[model samples]
Target: MYQTKTKREKIKLFLIILIPILITQVSMYGMTLFDTIMSGRAGAADLAGVAIGSSIWVPVSMGIVGILMALSPIVAQMVGAKQDQDVPYTVQQGIWLSITIGVIVSILGFIFIDPILSFMDLEPRVQHVAKYYLISIGTGIIPMFVYNLIRCYIDALGQTRISMFIILLSLPLNIVFNYVFIFGKLGLPAFGGIGAGIASSLTYWIALGLSVWIVHVVRPFRKHHIFRSWSKPSFKSWISLLKIGVPIGFSIFFEVSIFSAVTLFMSVYSTYTIAAHQAAINFASLLYMIPLSIAMTLTIVIGFEIGAKRISDAKHYAYMGILSGMFISIFAGAILYIFDDPVARLYATNPEVIELTKHFLFYAIFFQFADGIGAPIQGVLRGYKDVNITFWMSLVSYWIIGLPSGWLLANYTNMEAYGYWLGLIIGLAAGAIALFTRMYYLQHSLQKKLDTQQS
Candidate 1:
C-alpha cells in the first residue's frame, strides 16, 4: 500500500526507532542472560535456585509491566493527535498504576514465594536459595515498574536514545556489580546467587533515580511537564488502561506459562533432552528480541497514526512492519538452521546433548517464521488498541490446539519432546494466521470507512 518513497521513509523511521530500541532491548535482555550465567557459576543449588526464582518472578513481573504497556499507545496517540496536554495525565495515571501494582506484586511475591516453591517439590537447598533470591529481587519491584512507566512514556514520544544509553550503561554496571557481589570481589561478602538479586535490586534503584532526574531536568521532558503536577488515581482512567492492559498481560502469561508447563512436562525426558530444549529456547528468544524491538516500535508508530486518524497510512506502515519482520526472520532462521552444529556444540560438549540440541534447533527454526510474523501483527494491533482478541487467539492456539495435541503426542504417543515442538510449530503458525487475518479485516474495514467518509 505504501509508495516506494513512503515505504522508504517508514523504514527509515522504523530504523531510527528500531536501532535504539534494539540496543535498549539487547541491553535489557542481557540482565537476565547474565543472571542465568552467574547463577550457573555459583553452584548447582544456586543455579536451580535462580532458575526457580526466575520462573516464579518473570511471569508476574512481566504482567505488571504489560499492564503499563498501555502507556505506549496512550502517550503515542496523544503525541500523534497533538493532544500534548493529555499526555501528562495519562502517564501520571500510569505511574500510579505501576506503584500500586508493584507494591501488590511485591507483597504477593513474598507471601506466595514459599507456597509456589513448595508446590514444585524442588530440592530443599534449591528451595531455600530460591526464596532469598526472590526476596532480594522482589524488594525492587516498585522501582522496576516505575522505571518501565517512565521508559514507556518517553519512548512513546519517540525519544529512545536516552533510555538505550541508560540501559547500555546499566548492563556493564550490572555485570560488574553482579561479579563483585556474586564472587565477593571488592570487599563485599559473597552472596552467590542471592548476590545477583542484590545487584539487580541496586540496578533498579539506579535506573529509577536516573530516569526521574532526566524527566525533571531534561529539556525534552521538561516541556511536557510529566512530573509537573501529581495526578491522583482516578477510577475512570485506571479502568481505561486496565481495559487495554489486562488482556495483553494475560495473553503474554498464557504464552509464557504454557511453555513453562511444557518444561515441567519435559522432566520425563533425558537430561540431554532438557539441555537441548533449553538451548533451543534460549537461542530462539535471543533472536526474537530483534522482531520484538520492531514490534514495540510499531505499537508506538501505528498508534500515533491511528490517533491522528491516518487510517490508510496506519495500515501501510503496519504491513511494512510485518513484511520487514518476516524478511529479517528468514535470515535469522537460516543462520540458526545453517549453523545448528556449532551452536549446539557451544551449548554443551556431551554428544547426546549436542545431537538433541541439533534436532530441537531444527524444530525451533520452523517457528521463527511464525514468530517473526506474529510479533509485528501483535505490535500493529497494539497501536490500534486491539488486544483482547490476541488473548483469546493465544489461548486457543497454545492451550486448546498446541498444548493438547503436544501432550497427546508426547505422552500418548512415542514422539516425546519432538511431539511438543511439532505441536508448537502448529500452534505458533496458527496464531500467526489468526492474528494476521484479523488485522487484515480490521484494516480493510477501516479503509472502507475512510472511503465512505470521503464519498
Candidate 2:
C-alpha cells in the first residue's frame, strides 16, 4: 500500500535526501574547482588548457552520466511498488551498460582528442596541455561510470548519506593528488594542467573502490544481495534502461554542449578571456548545486510517491522543491552580485582575468534565476519519466534558440562574450516556461484520471 506522508513529513524527508545529495554533488564539483584553481596557479596557459579540455570532457562524459542517471528513478519506483527482488538485477544491468558505454567513450576520447584540439586552433602550449589532460582523465572513465551507477542505486535505496560520506572522504585525497602531481611534490614530476586530470582519474578509482566496499559491508545495501546473485547480460534490460536513459543523455548533452560551444567560441578571443569564462562558469555551477540537488531529491521523492499511487504527495513535493529552488537562487544571486570581485580573485591573480571574470558573474545572476525554476521542474519531469519532451525542449532551447542567438550577438554586436551569457539566460527562461507548463499538464492529467477512477 502507498504510504501517505504529511506535508511537514514530506519537507523533512525532502531535506533528508536533499542535504546528503547536495554535499555529494558539491564534493564532486569541488574536484573540478580544485583542478581549475591548481591549474591556474601553474600558469595562464595551463589554466586555459585545462579549461578547454574540461569544456570538451564535461559535456561528453556528463551526457553518458545522464544516461546512467535513469537508474535513480527506475530503482525508486520499483522500491515504491515493493519490487525489492528485482532491484539487484536492474542495478547489475546498469553495471553492464556502464562498462560498455565507458569503454566506448574512452576509446572515442583518445581517438578524437588530437583532432578536436587541432581543430580549436589553440596556442601550441595550450593545445599540448589540453591533449594530455584529456588523455589522463580518459583513463579512469570506466571506473567513474561504474561508481556513479552504483551511487544512483544506493541513493535510490535512501542511502544518500552514505554516498555523501564516500565523496567527502575522497575530496581531500583528490586535493593531495593534485598537489603532488601539479607541483612535483613527494618525488613526482610536475605535470601542471595534466596533473588535474591525473588527480581526477585517481579520485574516480578511489571513489569506486569505496563505493564497492560500502555496498558489500553496509548493512542496508548488503541486504539487497547485489553481489550474491549474478545475472546474465540481458538485451531486454539494456533496452529498458536505454528507453529512459538515452533521451536523458541527449538532453544533458544539448544543454551542456551549449556551454562547451561558448567556451570554444571564447577561445577565439584571448587566453585571459577563456580563463575568465571558465572561472565565472565554474563558480556559477557550484552555486547551481542547490537547485540541482533539490531537483534530484524531487525525482526520488516524487517517483516513489507516484509509483505508490500517491499523486497528491508527488505534486506536493514537486511544488515544495520548485519553490525551495527559486528561494535559494535568490540568495545565491545576491552572493554572486555582492562578492563578484572577491570570487573572481579566487580563480586568478592576473588583473585582466579577474576583471573579465567579474563581468561574467554579473550575467550569471540572471542565468541562476532561470535555472532555479527550470532545473527543479526537470527533476519533477524526470520523476514522471516524462523525459522525451524534455529532450526535444532542451534541443530547441539550448541549441536552436540559445546558441544561435548567442553566436549572432557575439559576432555581430558589441556584447562579445557577454552575448553568450544573455543567450543562456534567454534559453533557460524559455526552458523553464516550457517545462513548468508540461509539469502542470501532467499533474492535471493525473488528477483527472484519479478523480475519474474514484467516481
Candidate 3:
C-alpha cells in the first residue's frame, strides 16, 4: 500500500520541511550570538558566568524536550493513518506530561543551583554571577517546557511555520531586553548576568503565550478543543508516552552530557582557554542546529509514512533526508573551515582567545560533518520506534568510548584543551558510524518485512 511519491513531490516535501527548520535554527543562532555579544560587552567575567550557567541549563532543558519528542512520532503516525480526531487527545496528553516534568525539574534546579555551582568550583566572581543567573533562568523552566510541548505538537502536525514565525518575532525582543538589562540602557538598571537571565525568562514565556494563542485561537487550528478542554489526565496515555519518551530522554541526556562534561572540564583551564573553548563551542552549537532541525523534521515525516504502512516510502524518505543533511552539512563545514577566524573575532576581541579558538574551530568543522551524517540517521531510527537500540548505541558510543577517552586524553596526555575537543570529535565519529550501521540494518529489515507481508 506504499504510495511511491514522484520526484517532484518528494523534493517539494523536503523543501517544505527544510526551509522552516533552517529559518528557525538561524533565528536561534542569531539569538545566541546576541546574548554572547551582550554578555561580552558587560565583561569577561559576565561572559564566562553566563556560559557556565547555560552549560548546566541546556542539557537538562534539552532532555526534557527530548521526552516531549516522543509525542511527535506518535502524532505523525496518527495523522498518517488519518485518525484526525485522536490527534488532539494525544497532543493534550503530551502537554500535561511535559508540564509535570517541567515542574519537577524547575523545583530541583532552583533548590540545587548554589550547591551545584559550588561543586563546579567556579572562581568566586564567576560563582557569584552564576548564582544570580541560575536563580533567574531556573524560574523560567516551566514555561520553557510548556513551549516545547506546544512546539512538538505543532511540528507533529507538520505546522512548523508557526514555530519559525514565533522565533523570528521573539528574537528581536530578546535582544532588546538583553541590551537594556545587561548594559543599563534606556534608563534601566544594569542587572548584568542576572538581567540576561531575566530577559531570557520573560521572552520565553512571551513566545510560549504567542504560540498558544496562535495555535488555539487563530484561524485554522482554533476549532480543536484540545487546547480549550481542561480534561482530567489520562493515566494510560501518560504511561504510553512515558514508556516511549524516557529512553529517548536518557538518550538525549547521554549525548548532551558529553558536551556538558567537556565544558565543565574546560573550566579547569586558564580563563583565556575557557573563553576560547566557549567561542569555538558556541559556533559549533550554532552549526549543529542545522542537522538537528533536519533530523527532527525527517523523524516526523518518516513517522507519518510508517504509520500509513508505507514502510518502503518511509525508508526512502529517511534516506533522502539523511543525504540532504549530509550534503548541506559538508558545505557548512567548509564554510566554517574558511571563516573560522572571522567567526571567532565576531564573539571576542581578545587576540589570544581568538587565536586559541581558531585551533579548535578545525575540530568543530570535522564534528559538524559527522553530526550531519549521523543525526538524521538516528532520527530515522527513532521514526521506526527502534528507540531502545538507539539508546544502547548512544550509551556505548558516548559513555563507553567518549568519556573515558576524553578523560585519558585531557589529563593523561599533553593535549589539555585540545584533548577536550578531540574527544568530542572522536565521540561524534563513533556515534555517526554506529547510527549509520543501525539505520542500514533496520531499513533492510523493515523492507524485508514489508516484502514478506506483501508476498
The candidate with the higher lDDT, 2 or 3, is 2
Candidate 1 lDDT, 1-455, residue by residue in tens: 11223777878787788889889988887777777567656665665566667666777777678778889998888888888888888888888988888888877776887787777756677667778989998878899999999999878988888889778878888999889988899888888878888888888888888888898889678887878778889989999999999988887777666666676566455544655676666677778888888888899889888988889778888888898899989999999989999977655566776788798889888887888999889889889999999989989987898888888888888888888888887888898899999899888898998999999
Segments of candidate 3 deviating more than 4 angstroms: 1-4
User: What is candidate 2's lDDT per residue for 1-455, written digit by digit as tens?
Assistant: 13545878887888889999999999999999999999999999999999999999999988999999999999999999999888999999999999999989988877887788888869999998999999999988999999999999998877899999999999999999999999889888999999999999999999999999999888889988888768988989999999999988898898888888999988998999999999999999999888888888988988898889888889999999999999999999999999999999998999999999999999999999998999899999888898999999999999898888888889899999899888888888888899999999999999999999999
Clashing residue pairs in candidate 2, if any?
Answer: none
CA-lDDT, candidates in order = 0.81, 0.91, 0.81
What lDDT score goes with residue 302 in model 2? 85
Candidate 3 clashing pairs? Answer: none
Against the true structure, whose TM-score is highest? 2
Look at candidate 1 and give me any clashing residue pairs: none
Candidate 1 Cα lDDT to native = 0.81
Which run of 10 residues does model 1 get worst, by summed lDDT? 1-10
> Which candidate should be chosen as best, given lDDT against the real structure?
2
For candidate 3, write residues 267-330 as lDDT tens digits.
8877667767777887788878888888888888888889998877787788888888889888
List runs of model 1 lying over 4 Å from the truth.
1-5, 267-276, 341-359
